[model samples]
Target: MRKIGGLLLCCFLLNGLNGQHQVKTRKELQREVIRCINESAQQYKVMMQRLDAARFPVTWYAKEDKLVTSGSEPWVGGFYPGALLYLFEYTKDSALYKEALQKLNVLAKEQYNKTTHDLGFMMYCSFGNANRLAPKPEYKTILINSARSLASRFNEKVGCIRSWDSDPGRFMVIIDNMMNLELLFEATRMTGDSSFYRIAVAHANTTMRHHFRPDYSSYHLVIYNPANGSVLKKQTVQGAADSSAWARGQAWGLYGYTMAYRETRDPKYLEQARHIARFLLQHLRLPADKIPYWDFDAPGIPDAPRDVSAGAVICSALLELATYTPLKESKGYMKAAEKMLQSLCSPAYRATIGGNGGFLLKHGVGNYPRKADIDVPLIYADYYYTEALQRYRKLGMKR
Candidate 1:
């Protein structure tokens, strides 16, 4: 009798533990999301008060417990203000809207910058969001000028925009350039000019031809002979190796192609987006939490530092992708994205109030090989995280 009672007690305890693992109800998930967004607003309110007018926050130095600031030229300069606009869209706080406008004034000069391929990230993200929220004649002028600046880098021979000015003989294009195409697409829509759209499609086709491997994983950088559009070399500057998959690069590819499909409704772009999604979702090394390692093939497996920025980008892209795909495909992408959002909102990745130099997400690895912005809270990470939250909320409302 004593032995039987002990066995019954053990069975009951096991069942209780199993019950604890049940999925959260819709109401519970909504409450948690609201809490996360509210906490983010509070933190950013503090950061805006502390930031200087001339400097833009880039990332947080976790070890030193300090905020990293950048000048206007930094590729990531626009994301800070872009994030504020997204937060304001959610919270409707007048102060956030005012702060975002002030930051945009500081970032406005980048509309004429043509030296780098990141003008899309710098101008479009900040000004694009602003234009969407509040349409102003000035914003339209700034964005059109920015699009023209970006268009200046397009090379007819190479069929792609110049990603960097380095090694003038070789035309270097990186996977990240895909994210810039949206600016061109938007410019075409706004200006009734097909030239911008033509340039964007040409670049996407060129990238699709050379940048991807048989397995659908992308190289970080592909060098081409500018004279004949011949491939010079395929390599990676920030990934684990030339052959390895960089987490953030994959995210860019996924998001870029997804946006391309939306703009063009091209079956090839849609197929490419689906392939990239499958590669990321089925990769053997992907973490259980859905936040990927800095590089998928980076050494140390489970011990590698996770890139929350990559995860945020993937989450936002997946949510958008879900809307385009068939129901069968959409289910997988949406489920994976929801899991990623839940992980990102947890305490491990999401910053608590007054923590992480007021950044929303933590553990972003930027340029791991170059030893820059490792294990930091990056502004881009926060930008995409807020975007993902908004996307998720909209998805919920639809359901």
Candidate 2:
């Protein structure tokens, strides 16, 4: 409770400082922050009421039609709780926290919904991260056990987290595994278990070995045999399978490595991040305005589809990279970050058509198999953009 109070207070201090005169003293900033959090709490309360009234459950939706805010059904493992956790972060309301916790409790117990590739976004985003910042026993047990379950899915011979239930008996990895590795890592920390962390590092090392191309751009799918730790195949699970780069896959690589670097301070992870960032920047035809198309070298150029989610995610990665880089590299990455942020904040990419939905960018294509959300707003894009905006405000042109 005290931690939550502190968080809410910090939030107030953060927002309260905004839209006000330049503050010459820390005291003034502190005062403004408290006021802001209080005001924000009220707004969050109203939002919670509206959100709940709509019946939004915190679960991943595999298809567009399943995205209705409320009810009993679940799409995948990550969606619903992830949204609620974000809301709880803003509000610091116990009710929201408990509600989200309750959902996680249920998902943790449900044995059947555990086979997907989204463990990080599903478990970590919903509870693991929260546990790091705020410890709750039920929340902790559920998240750790959930991480263990995901870890169990790892085929020791493959050296990677398995993906795609269709290949049920087989072990394969996807580019998205990078994000979920955090679950394993955090689970290890929470449980004092070496097996979990070891598995995570092995998966990451294996990914580095096979998934990335000579240019540092990555393939979307890699088949590995857990029995002997050999890669059977590496392929693109999305995009034109002829080795075409999926822009979001590239973003995942960038963000994921940067995250790995943050966790281990490994030079290889940092180097990989730089290599991928360079490939993305140099090859991607980012305009003076700066958002990128769905692929860096997407065929058909101007007519190619755009994935604003990539731009938002890459911006977040670049900023984190800048934090540890040398001055020159940091400045360059910072400038790129600003460019991407401007691209999203600009009229061209953002959606004004939504009915009070906070989705910042449209055109995130998940699997063309579900062609429902083409050219429409995505929730994560908005979440990441908001995170970037908050960071930008705090750091003040950090480059």
Which one wins on TM-score?
1
Report the poorest 10 consecutive residues by lDDT, candidate 1.
13-22
Candidate 1 residue pairs in backbone clash: none
**Candidate 1's TM-score:** 0.94
TM-score of each: 0.94, 0.76
- Which lDDT values do the candidates have, in the order given? 0.88, 0.64
lDDT of 1 by residue, 10-33 (tens): 334433433343355656666777
Summing lDDT over every window of 10 consecutive residues in candidate 2, give the lowest-scoring window: 14-23
| Model 2 Cα lDDT, one tens digit per residue, 1-399 | 995565356334423422332323334433433443334334334435445432443212333324335342233344445545554565577875665665666556532346665767666766664565578887777777667777767766677777776765556788877987877777777778889888888888889999988988899888766568777777876765638778888898999999898877889999999999899888746544456666666665554556767787898889889887999998889878876765565445554432224233545555532454444555556556645655555565342
Angstrom error of the Cα, residue 247, model 2: value is 0.5
Over 4 Å off, model 1: 1-22
Candidate 1, residue 93: the lDDT equals: 91
lDDT, residue 192, model 2 = 88
